[model samples]
Target: MSHKPRGLRPDERELWQRVAEQSVPLHPERAHPVKQVIERLNKAPAKHRVQHFTMGQTARKIAPQHNLAPHITDHLMNNHVQMDRKAFGKLKRGKLGPEGKIDLHGMTLAQAHPRLLGFIQSAHGQGKRLVLVVTGKGKAGTGTGPIPERRGVLRHQVPHWLLSPPLGTIVMQVTPAHLKHGGDGAYYVYLRRRK
Candidate 1:
């Protein structure tokens, strides 16, 4: 990734307290941070397990039923998502464990971005609403740190990534998860089907 890794900003340093304590790499065997998971996935030359959903079918099938107020989509499309602790939850192991769960534990930002879009497309197509993405809060904080804070990376950057480029047009809104589902660490990503 070309993004510069600088020291964490004051705000990020604060965020580090919450994030660093929670996140863990998805693959224990790999021994790397979760943010690097995506890059490794791209280079592994083994398998692409993350499911992909198409844009067209999702637009035609899912968008019509979300009951999204006409203007809400537009507003979300053009606005910045203001994250608040009021909207997040920790995932219950029963509800979010395995089967249909998408494990983002070790995925890199680049790998996670496309897969997240496809996931939204697929879920939207299947007439599903209110999908959950489990982005860890982060594992490194201020003290005893080898990597500088900015490498704290995905902890704060994922939100911007969601609002940029190809994914941005497909998504209408994104908010921090509710308290029952890994709040602040996860996101409630709302997708918009094309008109």
Candidate 2:
């Protein structure tokens, strides 16, 4: 049940009236903060306005076709891998233990890129065939911001780096790690036997 507000006593009402009569408005001429802010914003010319693009439009602009042959390029144009039936079987079966492994967590692009190249080169030098590269499935971005945040930059970029020259020539194949290994956040890098 809703309760009504109690009526003020006669003495209380008189006291309230006296106080109200004595009290003058403080800063009655003051402009509202929100209004002032709106006025300032109206006066300023906005430099950057939001631009919307469809998926196809964005893909056309951001993703250009590569001149490289399909065989040399990974499915994502990131890494190159050619695996025969037996090699594919071995990798998928998780029969081969990673001779080397590198975790690329909490590292920025600048730090991760060079370290990745170095790790791969070193593993290749050691004649290691199967190695693991871990890139955590990045956190989902907060959707409120103007610019969209991309998740799993390394997950996408690592494949590209693996397919690029110098390392590409050495990297024989790359496959997504099995669930036992690291699932989506990791890769199984199979290197060519040292010549």
Candidate 3:
């Protein structure tokens, strides 16, 4: 059975009126623009015409999508060269060999930070110039959230750590390692000369 349309109850109408009076339009300009546009269209001649198109016609191109943030490697490369030009070139080309190396795989943030700090400090203290830091490319995230989550927490955080605080004073430059030395998953940390 179909129900008949009925007017709002007296109490319901009073409540609606009170709500309407207190509510504010989010966009006051937009509220009546549609009505104005409709009134103008009714007063004007229907001169506008739709373009003709066949079913197989090619569609117009859409604007290109906004790009994701620059890659981790890009961020590392963009940093100002803090070491000698010749040495930096060799370092990038994988010509410069690390005097020491540290692997930070399978460790929590708490365990990794201190270990990294100690290793860098020790290397600097021993007058080491170039060292390799291995922070394996992080595992892929499992979440399906709207905001994209980056994989490899250590890969991202290690650079910032090397560039800040007690380590920053001793560290000179940080660059991605070559394939033979675990490319993309490791960093070549150039340290300052021990004073």
lDDT of 3 by residue, 1-195 (tens): 998989899999999999999999998867497799989989998797889988857977664433378878899999999999999999999999999999999888999999999999998989999999999998977646656777788998999999999899999999999999999999999999987
Q: Better model by lDDT, 1 or 3?
A: 3
For each candidate, what TM-score against the reference?
A: 0.42, 0.57, 0.65
For candidate 3, what is the lDDT? 0.91
lDDT of each: 0.58, 0.80, 0.91
Candidate 2: tens digits of C-alpha lDDT, residues 142-171: 646656555577876787788788789998
How do the residues 33-149 of candidate 1 rate in per-residue lDDT, one tens digit apiece?
A: 775887887888876597787667555453223223333223333555433323222222223321123447677888877777777667767655356777777675454444334
Stretches of candidate 3 off by over 4 Å are 1-68
Model 1, position 140, has a per-residue lDDT of: 52
Could you tell me how far off, in angstroms, the CA of residue 129 lies in candidate 3 after the best superposition? 0.6
Angstrom error of the Cα, residue 157, model 2: value is 1.1
Best of the two (1, 3) by TM-score: 3
Query: Worst 10-residue stretch by lDDT in candidate 2?
Result: 64-73
Residue pairs whose backbone atoms clash in candidate 2? 78-159, 78-160, 79-159
